[model samples]
Target: MKTKIIYLLMACIFLVSCQNLNRPSGQMTRVERVVSGQTIEIADRSVAVPLLEPIRLIGIQAPDIRQNPWGQEARIQLEKLTLGQEVLLEFDTQEKDGFDRLLAYVWLGGKLINEYMVKEGLALAKPDFPNTKYMERLTNAQEKARLMGLGIWNPNQPMRQTPGEFRSQNLKQ
Candidate 1:
């Protein structure tokens, strides 16, 4: 009987630990670090306990840090907008990326940061990802930014590769 009780107690503990593995979908958190224009480290405050997780912005892919002027500009803009700010995170069907980054739609005040980045021409609409909750909105934003010659959209500017293209070539070693 003691062995059975011990096994039952262990099972209960395992269940609880699994629940804590990821934040519940559609929660609010404070941005503690901007990993890039498309990713951030956020601290969940809904629980009595808080934990930090890196969240990749859904539907948009920003320039990589090594992508030169555009990459640096995107990171700077992300920092300016999100560092130390509160954001609401809305998760899609897939909660995490292969890299273990939480995937979310981030809201700063009323603005959607994912769409904002594409709208501002700092990122590209990532259609390849399966979780495409905001793909249409992001694509529209990218089009508008392109027509307006904003950020990386300027025709006179040097051709800037998408983050995916950059990573595919540079990270292929």
Candidate 2:
């Protein structure tokens, strides 16, 4: 009887651990501020340090702040959508970038913020490997935005270069 009980307990523990492994590693947090079109500062009390954590929205890249109208427009759009809002942060395979910013998919009011930005043409789909969980969704949104000639995709005043390209060029100067 003792051996049977021990085996049963072990089985229960194993099952619980397996379930945890399959669960989505996401957290609920409130947005402290919109850092930019593709980044936001969130309040995460769960962490020991950095009460305000900066999170980079995965699957999209917004124009740099110095990229002129498009950049400012992107930031404004993001602020309107997420400022002071409660968001759910979902992780991909890669959690942090070289800059130590948390990489995540921000979901607010049942909408995926990362995809929304791309769809609105305020940002471009940037598929970084190991974090391509939403690549197809983002790409489709980008295509639709491009077709509609919205925001950065506007033919009359289209963005001259991608944010990455702009940054690289600036670095050379």
- Please report how far candidate 1 places residue 15 from its true position, in Å: 42
**What is candidate 2's lDDT per residue for 53-139, written digit by digit as tens?**
899999899999889898888998999989988888999999899889999999987789999999999999999789998899999
Clash-forming residue pairs, model 1 = none
Instruction: Give the TM-score comparing model 1 with the true structure, all chains together.
Output: 0.78
Estimated TM-score per prediction? 0.78, 0.82
Worst 10 residues of 1 by lDDT: 21-30
lDDT of 2 at 77: 90
List residue ranges in candidate 2 displaced over 4 A: 1-25, 47-50
Off by over 4 Å in 1: 1-25, 44-51
